[model samples]
Target: MVIPIHDKNPVSRAPVVTYGLIIANVVVFLLGPIAFAGPDPDAGRKARENAYLYHYGAIPSQLLGGAHGGHGAPVWPAFTAIFVHAGWIHLLGNMLFLYIFGNNVEDQFGRVHYLLFYIVGGALSTYAFAWANPTANAPLVGASGAIAAVLGAYAFLFPQARVTLLLPFLWFLPLRVPAWLVLGFWFVMQLPEFQQTIGVSSSSDVAYYAHVSGFVLGLVYAALVIGRGRGPDDPLRLRQKAESEGSGTPPLAPDYRSADPDDPYGQYHR
Candidate 1:
């Protein structure tokens, strides 16, 4: 899995929405496990503890009425699940990717538009997964689908932009690669996995279809939304002008430290 570490182009606007999303996801995960605490310590221990996720988790079967389970109270799991995570690794991974890619996309869409894009992207992704596996009975959760949208937007808006990645071959080594090369490669890789899961009989525990669908939607949405802006030559022209005038590689990575002085999460870095 090629994870993005940094973007080649920095955003001109604030990343309040991005950081807020990170905080929201973290808070939901913390509350989910505790809120859904079960009664029997052994019999339904796992089920009770994960009640919040199981009931609210995006289950294709439940959406299609092929299965039954999920919270009846509040009835907001569909949207809430986006913030809930199964574990620390899941939470951290999603937050990290969001922090890395979200800012630039936010810059492109502006805060309000970016927020809308994220929610709609996630909702679309969930619908895609439900459509693909309507009969499967499994709870789907995670911000991956939404984050995939951001990556898709990043791919289109800044294809020439570079990303700093840690290539794990023998040792952990950091290398810079063009965004198109990394994200495009990732977008292509999802197709095969999506195809393989097409006719499976068993319910897929993982929502792979959601990721693929969200990515495609993101690409289409970005093309329609951000594509109208300055042509592809604009960024290159600006970069060239900056370089000729003795500026460092185009402002790809934002100075997060200064962007949010009291960044409560403490994850933002320069």
Candidate 2:
């Protein structure tokens, strides 16, 4: 298995939208019934979880018609499903991707646009999943689809940026590689899963269709709509400016630092 550690790219702004999205997902997961703080069942922990997931999850049948699983899935659950994670591992995995890749995209699109893109991309992806499995009854949950969009945008906009990945095959060795290669590998990995609409015959709960659709949509949208946003306040300029202010480098880059100062992603020299 491969796990992304961090990226070399830095953002021009504070990425409050990314931070806010993370906070919102975490809050939803904690407050939701799938967190096990729900109405305690006499038994069947798994049953309660299944019930909870299907209740709030975006069921293809409900979204597309011919409802199954006793009752219909939540009304228009695409938006709600993005905030609901089925388990701790699910929550952490999605959040990790979001945290690692989301900031730069948010910076590129600014807060509002990025947030709208995220929500719309996620909803569209969920619908794509539903379209494939029109008869499926299982509910789809988690923010993977939206995070996949962030990955797509990041890959397209910062193809040369370095991303450090932890490779479990090599005993968790850290491998630093270009963003395109990392994202390309991710795309290739999702290919087989893409053959199936999520929740059809798959025992696993992963929404691979959503991931594929969101990634493609985000990539296309990044190219057509955002297109890197490398004007006056580009990432390179911010990095250079940040370095010059702190390091001994000459102050040749434009100043784009926010009025409030504390930046955790310290000055990048190279």
Best by TM-score: 2
lDDT of 1 by residue, 112-181 (tens): 9999999878867886887887776557888988998898888787776657777666365766677788
lDDT of 2 by residue, 129-228 (tens): 9998888877888898888888898888778677778998799987777789988878766765543644324435567788888899889888887654
Q: Candidate 1, clashing residue pairs?
A: 8-252, 9-252, 10-251, 10-252, 55-70, 55-71
Point to the candidate with the largest lDDT: 2
Worst 10 residues of 2 by lDDT: 257-266
After superposition, the stretches of candidate 1 with alpha carbons farther than 4 Å from their true spots are 34-44, 66-76, 192-204, 229-269
